[model samples]
Each structure stands twice: as C-alpha cells, then as structure tokens.
Target: MAVQDLLRQRFFPHMWCPGCGHGTVLNSLLRAVLELGLSKNEIVMTSGIGCSARISGYVDFHSLHTLHGRALAFATGVKLSKPELTLLVPMGDGDALAIGGNHFIHAARRNIDITAIVMNNRIYGMTGGQFSPLSGIGVKATTAPYSTIDNNFDVVELATAAGATFVARSTTYHARECTELIKKAILHKGFSVVEILSQCPTHFGRKNREGDAGQMLENYKKITAKRGSKALEENPGLIGRGIFVEKEKPEYCQEYEKTIALAMKGAGR
Candidate 1:
C-alpha cells in the first residue's frame, strides 16, 4: 500500500511541468488505490493523448496509452474482454470532453463498469493553449485570441444526464476529498465518473493570468464549495463539489453475458 511501490521507478522524474496539478492528482490517485487495497495487477489504467493522460505511463500497472480521445473506447474493450480487471481511465479536459465527447456520453449511456477520472485543466495544456469544452466562456486561448465564446460543460451535470451510475466532482486543491471520491467511484457498480479540476500552470494559467499553480489552487479553494453547501447558496459563482449522483444499475458486461446465455440456450449448443 506504500505509494512508492505503486510507481514505475525507471520512469521517475515525471514529464509534467513545474507547478502542474497533474502530479498532485497522480499522488492522490495512488493514495486512493492503495487505501482500497488494490494490487497493481488488479488495475488497468488507460489514457488519451494530453498532459493528464501521461499518468497512465507513470503508474506501475497494466496500462494503455491510447490515441487522442479514444481512451474510453479502449477501456471499454478491455473491460468487455477481461471483466475481472478494474478499469481506471484518466483523461484531460479536451481529451475527455472535446474529441472524446462521443465516447464519453456513450460510455455513460451504456453504464459500463469502469471508473473514469477526468483531470480537467480547462485549456488543452499539452497541445498549446486551445480552448477546451470545460474551459469557461470568455476565456482566452491560442485558438481564441480575444476570448473563447463557447459555453463550457458542467461535467457533473453532463455525466448525470448521460446516465453514469455514479458521479463526483472535486478540485486538485481538495486532494483528500478528490481521493475519497475516486475510491467511492471505483467501488461503484456501474459507470462512474470523478472529475478533478486540475491547474495547468503552463497553458491555462498563463493564458488566464491565474498566476502560478499555487495561486491558481488558492483561487480554486475560494471559488469552489461542497454540493448543496451554504457557501454555494451564498456565492452564486462558487462551483459545486462532492458526489452528485449514485445509483444501482445493471452493468453492460453483465447484460451482454445474459444475451449470450439466451443465444446459447436457443441454439441448444
């Protein structure tokens, strides 16, 4: 359960930039996995192309570093083939909500048994400061010199509407809460989503004038509140945190097995 034991020593000195929240999130994740008493062999991590996605490479576990925005697709396939292995998918803001939008919704709709952790840094940190679907309206990006006018996604709401059985939200500033929520999501039966608002000091931070990672995290603490808390009621702009939804549902792979059973019985083979 020690954190160091979960790391791939040869790949030490991660590639994340200084002040990047990705490192913090990764540590929180390892903590959660360790606390859950899960062995590295029992978990399979998958990721799409982005800074956050790089986490899949650092962990000493079965992992798939898939193409951009296709992590869920690969994760789903892996789950179907090997239902016993726990699927842990980590994706970036744009990687999860923009290019992977289709896969995101479909995965939720199917109610597949996989735990997806989205490290939402607002802007596309890995590929320049491009506006991501989770980036707030009026934010500046390389693609939007003046400001990005597109409406941002409320990830928790989106996941709930898409039919994920369990949904939770937390910020990198709230590392303890984030790790706990991740643990809960992983243990949930059906599709689960845990959104972590990470700070990208390299791209989003510079573009938004959020100062360094420390300053950005301080802002996050001031702007976010637990779901249904008095702070949210007092401050309309405060983002809501905590689990939004948790419900039991028949999982996709289980349903597929039933269908296969019926087919075999009908064929009398």
Candidate 2:
C-alpha cells in the first residue's frame, strides 16, 4: 500500500511546526516502508523521548513509545520476541547517542536484528537546545551560549566500528536519497543504522543564524552536493545517495537458530 494511504491522518495535527526537518525524515521513512510493499501490520516503529519520538504516534503500525534514550533496547526485545516483524527505531541524537549510547554500541556489536534511524539534529530540541554528542565542536547552541566545547561523534563511523552490519548517513534535504537509504537499511538482514542529519529550526536554527527550516534545507543541499561530488572523485562507484555498506554477514537470528538446533539435538528434543 502507498504510504499516504497508510498514514494515520488523525495524528497530523501533532506534526512538528513548519520547516521542521523531522517531518522530512518522517516522510522518507514512510516512503521507504511503502516502497518495500511491506504490510503496515508487519512493521513496528519504536522511538525514544524528544521531538522524533512523536513519529511513533503518527505512523500506522505497531508502535512503541519507549523511555528516553532506550529505543534500541526496546527494539531489540521486540525483534527477538517476534523475529518476523520489521523493527525500526526512530530516535533523536541525544536520545540515541547520549543516554542510550551504551545500548546502541552493544546492540550494534551483537548485530541485533533491527534497524535504527537516528535523526541527528545535533542538539536536543524537545527540552531546550542543549548540545548533543553529534554537535560540531564550537558550534553555538542554547546550552553552549558561547560554543560547543565537546568533540562530536561521527555517528556512521561510530556505528561501523561498533559492528553495525549496515551504516550510512543522510540529511533531511535529500528527501529521495534519504528514503532510498532507509529502504536499504530496512531490507538489510542484520543490525543497520542510518544516521539522518536533521535540523531543529525551532531551537538549533533560531539560536544560530540558520534562518529557519527553509534556510536549513538549503544548507543540507549545499553540504550534500559538495560531499557527493568529492566522493565521486574519490570513488566512482560511490553513488551520491546509495547504500555505503552491503556485505553478507552472519545475522544474529541465523546464529541463534543454530544455537537452538544444537541445544535441542544435544537434549534429544
């Protein structure tokens, strides 16, 4: 079914304010799900606290609105229990990187059967504009009235090093591109993480001179264009907006099946 038809329109009123990048990410997610032709009943959207968490409420699917910074853990449980449904987590930067940082790493290391889409606005938008772990060093934020002193985490690099089977990054302005990346992640066999660089115009933008949603959108275009061009020169096969990681690996579920089979054989079940 098309995503528009599957949308829970009743929740539209709760959508983020105009020019909010979360909306773009949300649209991309829905498009990806629809393109996969997966039934809404078979997909579960899990989320943590922050503006991004509200996504779970709007999607027409089995949804779990988890506590702050623990969406991945919750997603892991849901995936393990069902093992058949698609588990997708939509989390904000601080929610996934700060409070839930440990769980994120372990989940990646285990190659859990789930996909996480972190909306990296680079700041905490839900509760004032606090600098997030992904915030560029010396970048001005509400909490960092002067400049962000902490070094930011390159989320894709971190996830790849932690053992995520699929790790990629995209920004909100690349709507079609972001959607394509998300679809690839969803179809991946093991743990996948798509770091979405979003913009919180209400907080991050208003605080800085990023104008508003419109301005931030333009910035995304510029950045993506420059990066894409450079990548092409470095690696001709590097599509501007395509899967960066795609390799066959031992999925966690497949290994678990082997474990159960061996245990049952040993016990003569």
Candidate closest to the true structure, highest TM-score? 1
In model 2, the runs with Cα more than 4 Å from the true position are 226-242
Score every model by TM-score: 0.97, 0.92
lDDT of 2 by residue, 134-158 (tens): 8877788878999887998878788
Best candidate, lDDT: 1
The predictions' CA RMSDs to the true structure, in order, are: 1.1, 2.8
How much is the lDDT of residue 83 in candidate 1? 93
The TM-score of candidate 2 is 0.92
Q: How good is model 1 by TM-score?
A: 0.97
lDDT, residue 25, model 1: 91
Q: After superposition, how far is residue 169 of candidate 1 from its true place, in Å?
A: 0.4
Report how far off residue 85 is in candidate 2 (Å): 0.7
Q: How much lDDT does candidate 1 score?
A: 0.93
